[model samples]
Structures are given as C-alpha cells and as structure tokens.
Target: MFISDAMAQAAGAAGGENVLMQFLPFILIIAVFYFLMIRPQQKRVKEHKNMVAALRRGDNVITSGGIVAKVSKVIDDNEIELEIASGVKVKVIKSTISTVVGKPAPANDTADKK
Candidate 1:
C-alpha cells in the first residue's frame, strides 16, 4: 500500500542527457585556453629562439641581470664573451642575454658613406 506502481513508472521515464553533451562545456574551455594562452606563449618562445640564434659579435646587448655590454665573441652554441668596459670581459651563457640593444655599424655602408 505504501509503494505505488505509477510512481515507479514515472521515475524510469526521466533519463539524463547524452555523455557528449555533458562534456561539451569542458571541451570548449580547453579550446579557449589553447587559443588565448598556450598558442601565444609558444609563438613568443619561437621568436626568442630566433633572436638568440641571430646573435653576432659587435652587437650591443643587455643581459637578464641588467648588465649592458657588447658581444665581443660568441664562444660556442651556448656561451658568449661580453665586453662591459674597455678590456673588461666576462663569459656569459647565451640565453642570459635579454635584449640586443643596438646593432653594430655595417662596414660596407660606412665605407660607402665616407
């Protein structure tokens, strides 16, 4: 007398949504993150790698530690010699160079202007 057969039939009729519909919001959130965050970060990393690869002797640079110097020599793939003052040089890791300050005067252009 307490349990009704009509109530049991109604409960069975109400089913949940499909599995894909339940996970659609999560998938959209991940896509948003990739476009807004991860993609741009990867691009910046590529640009920094290209800039570091283009390093050459005589280019003025600033290190990550805020020291200003000129690239006196590129020691190897991962190291460089910086000339901070006249006859004062220090060896630093290439990645420690934060920015290329000013490029050296091009020899051919200077000679032509003279």
Candidate 2:
C-alpha cells in the first residue's frame, strides 16, 4: 500500500537536475579555494626556490629565523655558510634563507693586480 508507481516515476524524472543542484555549491567552493589560496602559495614557493638557487658568496641575507648575515660560502646545492660577525659563522640550509638583503660589491681588477 505504501509503494506507488507515480512516486517512482517522478523521482526518476528529477534525478539528474536535482543531483547537480545539490552539489553545485561544493564545486564553487573548490574553485574559489584554488584561485584565492592555492595559486598564490604556489607562486611564492617558486620565487623562493629561484632566490635560494641564485645565492652567491658575499650576498647578505636574512634567514627564516630572522637572523641577518652574509653568505661566506655555498656548501652545496642545499646548504651554505653564513657569517653573522667578523668570525662567527653558521651553516644553514639554502631554503631557510628568506631574503637577499645586500648585493656583493663589484669585483675590482686593480685590487687583485696589486
């Protein structure tokens, strides 16, 4: 007595339209997240990678920990030595460097010639 042929036919007819309407908000939210959050974060990471890869000795830099220092030497593809004082130095991961604060002075041939 509870089952009806008309009720089954109506649900079948509305299934496609109703399913899309129900999930439309979910699709919109995902699109919003990708544009507003994911895209900018990915761009920043790319810039950071390029900056770290271009590090050279004598470039003054700031670390992620806020330590300001100069690059004394590039130890490898992933590490470097930072001189924070006349003699004090620290070995840090390249990725830990946040910004290049100073440019290395231009090379002077006369100084070396003397």
* Top model number, TM-score: 2
Write model 1 residue lDDT over 21-96, tens digit each, in one string: 8889999999999999999999988888888889999999999999999999999999999999999999999988
TM-score of 1: 0.79
lDDT (0 to 1) per candidate: 0.91, 0.94
Show where candidate 1 strays beyond 4 Å: 1-17, 109-114
Question: Any runs in candidate 2 off by more than 4 Å, and if so which?
Answer: 1-13, 107-114
> TM-scores of all models?
0.79, 0.81
Please give, for residues 1-114, the per-residue lDDT of candidate 2 as tens digits. 457877888777987779999999999999999999999999999999999999999999999999999999999999999999999999999999999997888989999988
Error of 1 at 48 (Å): 0.8
At residue 103, candidate 1 shows an lDDT of 95
Worst 10 residues of 2 by lDDT: 1-10
**What's the lDDT for residue 96 in model 2?**
94
